[model samples]
Target chain A: MENIALLMHGFAIAFSLENMAAAIFGAVAGLIIGAMPGLGGITGVSLLLPLTFGMNPTTAIIALAGLYYSTMYGGAFSAILLNIPGDSPAIVTSLDGYKLTQKGLPGKALNASTVSSFIGGTIGIIILTISGPLLAEAGLAFGAPELALLVLFALTSIGWLLGDDIPAGLLATAIGLMFATIGVDPALGQTRFSFGQINLLSGVSFIPLVVGFFGFSQVIDMIISGEDGAVATKVRIRDCVPTGKEIKMMLPVSIREGIIGTFVGVMPGAGATTSAFLSYIIEKRINKHRDEIGTGSMIGVAAPESSNNAAAAGAFAPLLTLGIPGGATTAVLLGGLMMWGLQPGPLLFTEQPDFVWSLIASMYIGNVICLILAFICIPILVRAISVSKKVLVPIIIAVCVIASYANSNAMFDVVLMLICGILGYLMKLADVPTTPMLLTFVLAPMLEQYVRQSFDMTRGNPSIFFRGGICWFFIVLILLVSFSPLIKNFYLKMKDKKAN
Target chain B: MGYVLPGLSVLMGLYWAVKAFGYRLWVLNGPGGGLFPLIAGILAIIFGVVMIMRRYRTKKKSDFSVKSIFPVVSVIGIIIASYIIGLIPSLGVFIIAWMVFYEKEPWLKSTAVGIGTALVFYLVFDLWLAVPLPMGLFELI
Candidate 1:
């Protein structure tokens, strides 16, 4: 009953002319950014962070979160038409989506992708509304040791979960942590590695780093490849409609993936990219018509696109409730919110119910806007892609450098951006999962603070790491997962010997 | 793949494990602020070294393709030059020219497209967003 009243109140606030316009604008912008390869949800949201400077936190968060899900719809366009996945989460989509294009089913594949994204995204938003408060309460009782352990668990899971390249992933994560500490020390009121530079106080700006890594790097790709990139064909999309058979086939799978993805996304560290990859794998295993999965399978495009966007919505639960950002872009949002003097936590739910509730309402509104925009404005976005890369790459790089410099008007940021861009490209070449790097960058400072604070509380006792039984459990969980690679390797060796 | 193992081992040997003393010496009386990052850093390095020496050495390279690397390098250079040439209008002009010519769009169409995009940028960032654009040689109204 209260949920309904609160929801109605949220609708009242969300439906206001100003907020609605912002949501609409955000949807359109997000759609475009999502379609551009290398520019993911994180980069798109980070660019809009500054634009939210003057708005209310509720409205700002609503607009930004709206963009996050809108991308799932937008990412498929290029993947289908050009065979270039716009977002990493859409990589699964490219398999069957591009194949569909080759087989002259591009329009049908696009419709399945977008409509399923809307369905999945809506499910994620509702789960966040119902369960976020409870999760926040559960986290409130966890102390510093538990928090530290949780962050450690997150690092281990995200990195080692890649299965074969666990060590390289962890190393990339460590490098990201190193980058996180490059500026002034957050505590102790002193600078460590500033190297006597003035602009190192506030550390690196998020926008420039993301823009360079994802946005500029991709623009560079377009130019280097000499226009052989996606959208190379003169594909005239047919009736962008899924047949009833297609719709019937997708409804159950999308729902299952949506539920599973939202559940994972609400957890502190799991997010859209992981969810999309995992869901696509699961979809392939369970698909009734499995043979078509990687070759013009409509389910392939629908499954991941739906779940990935749903995961985007589910990620906000942690950000809103426990003051913990589940992913990179949410961390950027957290930083922006703090800069505006709004501390994220349980109090955000109670004192700023409108910020919580209206933001939820806006997700519902945003999903609809995304559906409409994707259905109507794809041809418009295609025009942007048609403009060619010779001019586009340099213009984007120039804009990215300027954007970095303008974050705080620091020249140092521009330099950091170029270096990070190179580093990002190198990481890509080395197959070091950028997810670990991104996750570590967001959580390292907080993890550091939690450890230091816990040690201080216990007055330098190393054994304090396992103070309570709950803390002990968390510590063991992290340790076990971190060392699982060794166990796996040993098992494989034994199996080889037995076979011989 | 060769770079992977070396990178990991080098990071392990050079960056964090050696910093223990400097960190302890620098802030003897303060909190053990460097402990977690130090430990994480060391663990990361050790794991990396282990992986490179053992796992990396055993792996084979079947997916290697270097046919199109030079063009990629050139494009990256063009991007860096975009920044070195002062961003905004000049870089925009350069990007447009490169795309049209190097990417092989016709000269007349490229010129029109370049001028159109330049005008759009002028309107969007300068007029609308209120960001100041570098006028440079075009400063004379």
Candidate 2:
């Protein structure tokens, strides 16, 4: 009942003209960005973040959050029409979505994806609304030790699960940690590793690094890959309407996956891509039309699309509750929170109910807005997707440069952005995942502060970290995640030996 | 391509570890500025070495080409040009140059895009946001 009152208050705030405008703009931009083959939520948010600097924190966050989830909807456009996924999470959608297009049912595939995405997103938001404050309430009990261990678990899980190479991912995490140490140290206020440069004293700025890694590097990638001009498929709005039986088939699958994807998104490091893959696998195993899954069934289109959108919504719960990022995109959002001088976590809910609830309220609006815009603007969106990469590449580069410079108005940061962009591109070529690095860079200082505080409380006794159930739980999870690769390797070897 | 990043990581880890020792590792009972970096450095070195070894074992072929260097070099040129002309104009020139020379779009279209984008950025960043974008030699004049 109290929650209902708070939500109503939140709705009052979100209903403001400025906040509504922000949400609408974010939704439109997110859809266009998501439909672009190379851009995703992270790039969209990073590029637009600098523009929000002058706005109030509540409005700024609403806009960014709107963009974040709507990208999940927009990502399906290219996947269904062009047989090319707009982002990683949409890769599974392309499997059946493209098949449907080949069968001249592109409109059906798109409708299934859109409806499921709406259902899944709504379900995920409902779960978040119920669970977010509870998680924050639970977080209030966490002391320095528990917080430190929890951060360590988040970092380790991301490093372990992100890519094929565990060592590479761990190396990225270590590099992020090393970078975090460059500015003033949290423990003693002593600056280390600044290399005597004035700009280094404040540490590497988050905006420039993020823009470079996600934005500028993408520019380089586009140039290298060379643009394949606009997608050729066209869809009329009337053809997009689904039949009653088709809706019936999609509704149950979407509801089930929506629940499952929310849980997956709540877990640290398991993001929309994981949720999409997991839901698709389950759909393949259990659905009556399982054999038609990869062969262009509506259930196939519905399953992953709904789950990924749900997962995108689910990611916000931890971010809002604990200040820990749920994935790479949320990590960028976390940095945005800090940039606005707003510290996230339990205190945010208690101290800034307007900000928390308003942001939450805006998600419901954003979800509906995304569905309406997606349905009404399918023709315009297809035209936008066909915009030549020749035009997009240079424009994106310009945006990246200006955004980086706008953060601190320092030419030095621009130079830093260029350097990071090159390094990020090189890292990509080496097949080293950059997401772990970005996540760690955002979280490392928090981890360091927590660890230092714990040590201070215990007078250097490390046993303080193992004192509570929460600490032990995180410790066990961290250890298991860290050794998971080795366990998998051993199991594979044993299976091979047994077969022989 | 594969070895380069891990190899750089090894060097960076060594440098960080060595520099970290100069800062006090411990301050009274708790850690000081250097402790976290020292640990991170050591872990980086260990992981970097393992990455190198794994790469060696797999021996993946490199997909890198000189074409990848074009964007990096072009951006460097833009930065240098920003100091001479100004950031907005340099970016304008970058767009025109990129579209004309590289993408081979029509001169009129490239110029229009270049000028139009620069005008929008100036309005948004300078006029609205009020970021003190560098004027470079233009400021002196």
Candidate 3:
């Protein structure tokens, strides 16, 4: 009942003119940004984040959070029309979505995707509303050891889950952790790795690093690859709506996939791309049209689209409740939160219930707006996919420059952004997973502080980590996640032997 | 490129580790500032060395191309110019040059793009947001 009342109050706040405008603007921008090939939710959010500065904290987050989810809706446009994924999560959508378009059912494919995306997003938000506070309550009981363990668990799990190459993932994480240690020690107040630069005292700013990693690096990729416009497709708005028969067939499948995606999304390290693929695989096995999944089937378009949107929502639970980003986009959102001087954890729920709930309320409103806007603007968005690289690259660089410099009014940050951009390009070329690195960079300082705090409480005995059940649970989970690939290989060997 | 990147990480890690070891490793009944960095450096060294060794064992194809370096060079050029001539003017120069020389767009269209982008930046950041942009030589504008 209290939750209901608070949520109602949140809606009232979210309904304000400024907040509503922010949400609608974010939805429109996110769709346009997400529909652009090579620009994903993370890049879009990082590049546009500067616009939210100097705004109310609630309004800023509402806009960003809206962008975060609406991008899932926007990504479908290019994935279906051009056979080019707008983002990583949309890769699966392009598989069957394009095939459907090729079969002259572009309308059906687009309709399925948009509807599924909306249902999935809506379902994910509902689950987030119920589970977010519960998780926060659990987090509120955590101590220093628990926090340390949880951060460790997140880092290890992300490293294990995100990339195919485990060593590269760990290496990336180690580098990020090293970078996190570059400033004045949070505990001891001693400068460690500044190398005698005055700006180094405060540590590497998140904006420049993020903008470089997700934003500028793509510009380099586009330049290097000489990639150009996506293939164009035509579809009338009147024909984009699914037939009643198609809708009836899709409703249950989308809901099931959406729920599955929500659960997968709630799990740390299982991101939207994974959820979409998992839903596709599960739908392939269970649906009556299993054989027809990849061959222009409606189930193909509906399941993954819904699942990815749900996973995006599910991702917010860990970020909001535990202060750990569920994926790369949420990691950027976490940075935005920090930039606004807001920390997202259990205290965010208690100390700023209005902000938390309003952001949630905006998600509900934003996703609906995203659906309507995406539906109405499909023609424009499809044409938008063909934006020439020559034009887009220069504009992107200009934005990167403004975004880097505008935040702190510092030229030093622009230089830092360039350096990080080079590093990001190199890392990309090396096939090293960047997400683990980014998450580690964000979480490392918090982990170090917690570990030091726990040690202080225990008089330097490491056994303190083992005493708490929650701490032990996380430690064991980390061990399992880190070694799971090896464990899985071993299990496969055993199963093979048994079969022989 | 693969070996050089990881090799650089190794060298950096060793340097950081050596420098951090000189600090108090433990203080105030807890792990000191140096401890985490020291740990991170050690991890970096170990993994970075492994990456380099693997590079030697497996021959990976280089994706680096000479054409790609041009964009990077141009971006660096723009950055240097911006520092000397302010951001908006530098951006105009970059946009015009990139479009006309590299992309081979018409000089007229390229100039339009250049001026249009500068105007948008000026209006958004300078006029509306009231951010004090560095005008450099273009301060008179």
Candidate 4:
């Protein structure tokens, strides 16, 4: 009964004229941006984050929520029409999505993809609505030690999952954590690495860093490694609707993948790409038409499309409940919320119940908006994909420069953003994962505060971290997550040796 | 190129680690401000050293491609331009230069894009969002 009342109140807030307008605008803009290759949810969200500065946190988040889900939906358009995937999550979608397009069922493939994306997104949001509050409620029981351990677990998981090169990932994470330690210590008021610079005293600004990391770095990439222009396929509105038999065939598999996607999304560091690929593999194993997965199979198109969208929603679970971002996109969202002076996690639920619930309500509305807009806007969306790099690149640079300065009204931050952008480009060159670094930068201060608090309470006894069963559980969880890659590698090596 | 950045990072990390050690690491009751930083600096140094060692062992090619310099130069150009003439004019100038020289667009089109972009930025930042962007000489106007 309480849940229903809160939900209704949330609907009242989300359905406001301004909030509704923001949601629609965000969905359309996100769809347009996400269809462009090399710019997906993270870039779209990061680029648009500055616009949210003047708005209320609820209104800000509702728009961002729309952008977040619709970006995932929009990513499929390019993957199906062009052989190119818009983002990592769309890579699997392209395998069969493009194949189907090649086979002259472009309309059939697109319709199935759109319907499945909506189904998956709807399931994920429903689960998030119910599960998010429960998770946050459970988290209200945690103390500093548990929170600190949770951050540690998240960091390690990010280092493991986000890294293709483990050592470099670990190095990037270490560097990021060190960067977070600069400026005055929140607990002790003693400056560590500010070097007496006034600007450095406030610590690194989040927006500048994010803009440098995602926005500036991408511009650098586009310049250095020139990319081919986008090639778009034409689609007719008449062919956009799937047949009844096709819908029936796709429904069960889409639901299964949606469930799989939600579960994968709820895990820290597990993202849409992982969920989509895992569901694709699982579908091939369980379904009798396994051989047809990559060969223009409708089942193949439905499976990954559904999973990726669901995973995008699932990725929100940890972000809202525990203040831990599950992937890069959510990490950007967490930063945006923080910029608005709104902290995510359990306290946010109690303190800003309206903000939290309204954002959730907006997600439900945003999904429907995405379903409708994604279909209605296909012709326009396809045209958006073919924007040339020459025009876009210089424009991006100008925007980055403007946005960085606007964030703090300081030229020093513009310089700082540029420096970080250069470093980000270097890190990419070295094959170091940027996600670990980004997340660690966000989490390090919180982790430090918790560690210090726990130690103070226990009078320097480290064992206080383990006194609680939850903290111990996190400790074990971190251990498993950190070493699992090594264990897997060893197991694989042994199997290879046995076969030899 | 691969080892250059990591080597520099190692030196910086060690310098900070020593500097951080001068502060109170553990204040009798609990860990102090310098404690986490000192640990972090030391870890950074270790990671840097590991990165350097791995680079040496792998014998990875660290050739500096001329292609990479184009973007860096472009970024530096924008920064210098923005600093000298103010942000809006500098943006207009930079876009024109980028489109004409690098992208090989026609002068007319580049000028149009440059002017249009500047106008849009003016309306959006100054008019709509009210962001006080650096106007340089334009501020006098």
lDDT of each: 0.67, 0.80, 0.78, 0.76
> Per-residue lDDT tens digits of candidate 1, residues A61-146?
87887777787788777666555556656656776786775565666777888888988898888877777777545434566676
Ranked by lDDT, the better of candidates 1 and 2 is 2
Q: Between which residue pairs do clashes occur in model 4?
A: none
Measured with DockQ on alpha carbons, how good is candidate 4? 0.43
Off by over 4 Å in 2: A1-136, A159-163, A225-363, A370-382, A429-431, A486-500, B1-3, B47-61, B137-141
Cα miss at A28, model 1 (Å)? 3.7
lDDT of 3 by residue, A1-500 (tens): 66777788999999999999999988987887676544568866886688888899899988888888888888877668655466767767876887786665676787899999999999988888877756434435566787678667655656433435778878888888888998988567888888788877889877677667666776787677765533223445566568898899899989999998887676555578767876776686578877788778888999999999999888888788789886778888899899999888878878989998998899899999988987787655444434566776777777677767765677788788788778877887776656566667777887888888888898889998998677778788888877877899999999999999
TM-score (C-alpha, index-matched) for candidate 2: 0.68
Give me the candidate number with maximum lDDT: 2
Find the candidate with the highest TM-score and give its number: 3
lDDT of 3 at A277: 70
Worst 10 residues of 1 chain A by lDDT: A228-237
* Per-residue lDDT of model 4, residues B1-141, tens digit only: 777667766776787688777757877577777776777778778888888898889888753466666656766777777666888888888889989998899999999999999998788667755667776666677
Q: Which stretches of candidate 3 lie over 4 Å from their true place?
A: A1-136, A161-164, A229-367, A370-382, A428-431, B59-61
TM-score, every prediction: 0.68, 0.68, 0.69, 0.68
Q: Which residue pairs collide in model 2, if any?
A: none
lDDT of 4: 0.76
Q: Give per-residue lDDT, candidate 2, residue B130.
A: 65
TM-score of chain B of 4: 0.85
DockQ, 0 to 1 scale, candidate 3: 0.48
